[model samples]
Target chain A: MALPDQITFASSPALSRNVVDALRAMIASGAVGEGEHLKESELADALGVSRGPIREAFQQLENEGFIELRRHRGAFVTTLRRRDIEEVYSLRIALEQLAMERAATRITPAILARMNEVLDAMQHVSPDAPASEAVALDLDFHDLVYEAADHDRLMRSWRYIRSQVSFFLQVRNRSHPDFVSVGYAEHRQIRDVLVAGDPGRRPTRSSTTSGDALPAPRRSRERPGLIAASGRRDPA
Target chain B: MALPDQITFASSPALSRNVVDALRAMIASGAVGEGEHLKESELADALGVSRGPIREAFQQLENEGFIELRRHRGAFVTTLRRRDIEEVYSLRIALEQLAMERAATRITPAILARMNEVLDAMQHVSPDAPASEAVALDLDFHDLVYEAADHDRLMRSWRYIRSQVSFFLQVRNRSHPDFVSVGYAEHRQIRDVLVAGDPGRRPTRSSTTSGDALPAPRRSRERPGLIAASGRRDPA
Candidate 1:
């Protein structure tokens, strides 16, 4: 059976991988709340697959740190902590900063156009739109940078943490209703920096603007400042 | 049944993850040569597990880029190319360099001692010892850095690319027989720098020394210089 349109899994004949993608999206989008128990039968029913693929996906998800499988108790969504946010952001900053550096040097006119296209799409998103919309466009902008960098393994590493980043962005979207406009300005600054073509000038651009690591829960305001200067803008 | 002692999996009760470790070890160690077909039944028999776990492991391995699942043709180990070496090394340098930087700042005396212990163990290995010996200690040295970084997601990113790095290091071990001793010196330099307590000074230390990456198979000689100053060593 074909995976539904909304499930953006890379096309593969392996039912389990598709199931992994579907379930991962559900978890990342918060359709399945953190710490919520996952029942194989229920997931199977929702995804229109069998328990076999669901079980297989559980193993992969456990390995990916997306969920925890308790012995005999089944799977539970891994709860995000302040540390998880900090860890993800710190690594994302390192990787994305490197990518931006490389992308700045190697970026082509076509890639810039594509990035502008994504930014234009971001311009259309409503401040009160679903978090997924803002999150999707935000990731697309970074994805273009990774693409321009053209380092296969580097992009692979970005993918490893992307879903988690998406989850955080979702939180940022809800927490900051003005994220659409604020995020737009931040992304435009990044694009303008790239267009300026001085990779060496702002080598630590992302991390510098991101402030220190997301040190505590109260400091969650500073978490999604990877590209956005959201830390300076009060959510309240 | 318990996984064998040689299998250093993280003591998970999940049989499939154990199988992933076993199969991953085989491929990374070159026991299952690149492009070799993996028979589920044969692997199941060899590992004394059911075909169920073998099948499940194949899915996970494919996701990890260790093997390719050809529709109806079973699974085959991913063939490493010069591009693979470059891609892996580029990202590894970015991630490991960041790890080393963070580790230098936040590292404890105990972690430094543990790193010293691994270096001492590497010192004892014969220059012509099995590639696996050199690879394990090489990874252990970097693993200590990731552990010292103490960022959960950063370490997770390290593990994501680790097996592939191991595979490349295995290639380095076989291609450069003197890798054991040379690798020891390189690791020692890194340790000394970390011990010097100046993360800010040598921020680009690893990449500056790794050269322009393993650009071609002819340049395979320069591939594993991630830590090793093999670029200047002259393999011939």
Candidate 2:
């Protein structure tokens, strides 16, 4: 009944998918330290599964850039060198800023209310709360932004980078106690900017541009590059 | 010597990586059309390899979002749905803008000159020239920006999306004649911006910031977020 650390993947059809999720959680929670080689034999033994599933799991995560598998050597939990952090955060700012700019124009009042609720929860979070709790709240808040932006590709890319962001933070043991309050303020600013910029503020303007006439030129900034082209227009 | 359609590993040290590269090339070039079913037996037969490497390579490409693997049904080449194009382009705009904004500040003269060489190649590429040639030149120009930005993770993410970008363009058969001239102009504009924005423009201002007081805060825009936190300062 009490099989701690054993991966009991209930109801999931794919064994490898469940294993990947379990292993990713373990890495994210610091259960398995970074730079530690993941031995198939040991993991297979501990999780009470065959080496086949473990190998497949390794392949899956490796593809996602979460782990690096060496030819002769075993898999290593990817440790974030300082550069990885800087690169990931730089991408994050570009994506989240663009998401906010778009979300601001399209976000519904219901979404804003939900975002405010997240901000309230963040404000009350204790200074000493676990970093995972804070990271979850932070990701959830931004997820709402991406969702509101209504860009499928953008959302997919964000989810991939989201795992990497949490991975590095966990490895470096870098989340500090004072960050809760600071993050709260930063998120609050984001929420305010979204509300202030929402075109739904004037519902008629949004309706004019809401329908399917302008599918290709989704963002105003990107239009100049392609629109100016003499060709490349869809006849539709 | 002409083993048409067969994947020859030859002298490559890593089989799976080479297979992944070859297969990715096939997909990107439209040699393997969208929605095509890739069977391990068939692929391994054609490539003159065993099923093992083919399976691993499929997994690798799947991880990169190039193909979809279904249970018992095998892998299917992902068709570039309209939204995928929109998604890739949206992410591209966010990424290129951030890259240009950063590259403008730090790009070196030699790098700008190399990018100029790419622009020259693009300008000469005839409208009848293959889309592949134009796409390669275009990527090279942007690659220079990513390199100048000097962010490894950013570059990695860019390359992943770059494949999908090329994949869709090739599939739709939509790289019109006017695009050659239009793309040439766009790339030139980008090159000009990079040269103008190099922080190295005013050598004295750059030199003052260069000698090691700051380590992590690479961009002028992102400093306010993490730097204000009480802990988590970069030891570098």
**Highest lDDT scorer:** 1
In model 1, what is the error at residue A124, expressed in angstroms?
A: 3.5
Q: Please state the error at residue A146 of candidate 1 in Å.
A: 1.5
Highest DockQ among the candidates is held by which one? 1
Predicted model with the maximum TM-score: 1
Q: What DockQ values do the models have? A: 0.51, 0.40
lDDT by residue (B184-225, candidate 1, tens digit) is 777787788788776563366442224212222455354433
Interface RMSD for model 1 amounts to: 2.3
Model 2 DockQ, alpha carbons vs. true complex: 0.40
Where in model 2 is the C-alpha error above 4 Å? Answer: A1-13, A29-32, A63-65, A108-120, A123-129, A167-175, A182-189, A197-236, B1-10, B25-36, B70-73, B108-113, B123-127, B169-175, B182-185, B198-236
Global lDDT of model 2:
0.65
The CAPRI-style docking tier of model 2 reads acceptable
Candidate 2 second chain TM = 0.73
User: What DockQ number belongs to candidate 1?
Assistant: 0.51
